[model samples]
Target: MAPLTSASDENTHQTLLNTLDIYSAPKPFRNASWKPPQRRNKNTKAILADAARKESSQVTTANSGTSTPAADTAPPNIAQAAQRLDRLVLEKSLIAPGPAVTYTNIEAAPSLRPERTRHYCDVTGLVAPYTDPKTRLRYHNVEVFNLIRTMGSAATEGYLEARGAHTVLK
Candidate 1:
């Protein structure tokens, strides 16, 4: 049996003089902090800020008077939860006067080491040396990174859910 070799079509070859960015920007430009739709909002800043202050004040006043110990322990309203803050419940937020410590083989240790290495690629299931900061997804290589970037939010959530990293809202 003869080996089949050289399967590329040469006549139809297109010149690769220039590479077009599918997303219309290089990595740095695409990953920059400044978004294109950034509005100066010079005219609306005061109005928006005033509205936000009013809303928050209303929420705080409505919830502050009804504060009980049980209610304090539970999560607060939507705005408070989103900001991870409640001015009324300020007891638990203070830091304890001690340096954080990690103890191995101690069941009650706040910081315990994992049983094994868990840095695996979300897409390829291989050893991942890089993480996509935006998605918080570990990928094995650039190919996996490109694949992850092309994925829709639902698909990304599916991958995160498979790893038990998806957030559940009550």
Candidate 2:
């Protein structure tokens, strides 16, 4: 039987790596397709101030006018309208349950930290640290950038040896 060679091994191994979507980075969209939803450019405070001034002027004009308007210049009560909306949107249960109590002991609580896995990807020549989708997820932009930089130089082996290694005893 012939001994396993690293050079020929890497060529076949890389082919399997190329087949997996895990190694591929997401591509940018090609077209300037669609615009986001329309929104008022003016700040909420500014818009409110302008509306208040307009309402005040309307009240002043009405007071100075010869004719007495039937309705007052007061803005519609938004809170009352919101209350009406609450009744319309939300339904209450016929019978209400008693206050619920939950028991939580700090001593018995599990730690928020996650368990770490030490699996490394030597197949792609990624000798340095890389993300494992299963555990220890990394989110930092700098770490992700570093991973991409290091990934290009990662060591890859032939597909047959890689597959055989999994079946063979350590």
Candidate 3:
């Protein structure tokens, strides 16, 4: 059997590196004839003019004291109409006397509350068996406990804040 030659090995290595370099480089943009469609300017102008004419005619009829069904039935503003509708609904509900079930009433039910709280490690997101009393942080093992112990007060507070247990002052 013939011994492996360095020249052929170097050439193969160089070819592999060149292939990797080609694959790593970004691909070139495609040469395409794509273009956006042109707008119908004349048709748009004619439609706008027709809309303006209709609006002007409506204004003239309104100014001449001719009452249309739409003008008579619709309110001046949408917000005021919504408020009036809300008031009517409230008045109707109050007059008819029914069960007044609310969000707070449902939440106050004993069955809705959890029986026991679940404790989880703040760092590893695992079930915590021990808690550090000083920082009040739950940990899975000594490693997480050591991590929490070495953290600064601000970092500890940040971790607590993420879990919605950080103390707040007014």
Could you say which candidate leads in TM-score?
A: 3
TM-score of each: 0.32, 0.21, 0.34
Q: Whole-model Cα lDDT per candidate?
A: 0.64, 0.45, 0.72
For candidate 1, the clash count comes to 0
* lDDT (Cα) of model 1: 0.64
- Writing each residue's lDDT as its tens digit, candidate 2 over 1-170 gives 43244555776666766766564866666556877779868864676567657755764575444333235553378886676556433422211122212233234345678687444443343333654343222223455545544543212123224434323337
For model 1, the stretches where C-alpha displacement exceeds 4 angstroms are 1-116
The local distance difference test score of model 2 is 0.45
Q: On residues 6-99, what C-alpha lDDT tens digit does candidate 3 reach at each position?
A: 5566677667677769668875674467676687456645665675577557555654432222455667888988876786667555543543
- Model 1, position 69: C-alpha lDDT score: 38
Backbone clash count for every predicted candidate, in the order shown = 0, 11, 0
Looking at candidate 3, what is the lDDT of residue 61?
63
Residue 11 in model 1: lDDT: 32
* Candidate 1 displacement at residue 117 in angstroms: 1.8
